[model samples]
Target: MSIDSIADAIEADAGEPIPGLREGLEEMRAGRSGRRYTPEQLLVRSARSTLGLSQQAFADLIRTPVATLRDWEQGRFTPPGAALRLMEIAVRHPEVVRDAAA
Candidate 1:
């Protein structure tokens, strides 16, 4: 929906009870609400974290530029198929990536 339509809907429902709004708010207040990440972002981040490596280190391990890794993690660009597969391997077996890096 357009921003104008969304604003109009909000104005119309100003005093109306919004379904699940209260529950969602409560979840946030309880610190249970989590930020969402795209699959590419998650994959890159997960792989890095799984290996306990910093972004630069992870990028080096993968033979990718740090800037490109950052872009992938930030969802600015999707990683190539080979990179994705390598990251998948890293996530599943971080030791392999670490050993290879050594």
Candidate 2:
């Protein structure tokens, strides 16, 4: 849809507060969005995002269990040595260590 179409849909939201947001959202759905990040390098969330992978996919890629990946991401447990090293690689060179399909 064009920006004008998104604008027309905006008012159709029945007086919602963020009608102007529709255009940006449409752009995002078209793969034309930008993201800002906080530099929390040691966090598992950061590692997974660096590789542009979902949590489950990142776990599978790194040969770690999903539950363990969750624990590390949620800060419930420390990442083990192997997991830590893998995350380090993700942090340093995500495109290098990450697979194309992942």
Taking the tens digit of each residue's C-alpha lDDT, what string does model 2 give over 1-102? 776666667756656546447667777878986654323325568789887888788878878898988877666677766767777777888877855435
Deviating ranges (above 4 Å) for candidate 2: 1-42, 99-102
**Which pairs of residues collide in candidate 1?**
none
In the range 19-54, model 1's lDDT, one tens digit per residue, is: 666555557667896676798789989999999889
Task: Report the number of backbone clashes for model 1.
Answer: 0
Candidate no. 2 TM-score: 0.53
Error of 2 at 101 (Å): 8.5
Would you estimate the TM-scores of all the predictions? 0.64, 0.53
Question: Candidate 2 has which clashing residue pairs, if any?
Answer: none
Candidate 2 all-Cα RMSD? 9.7
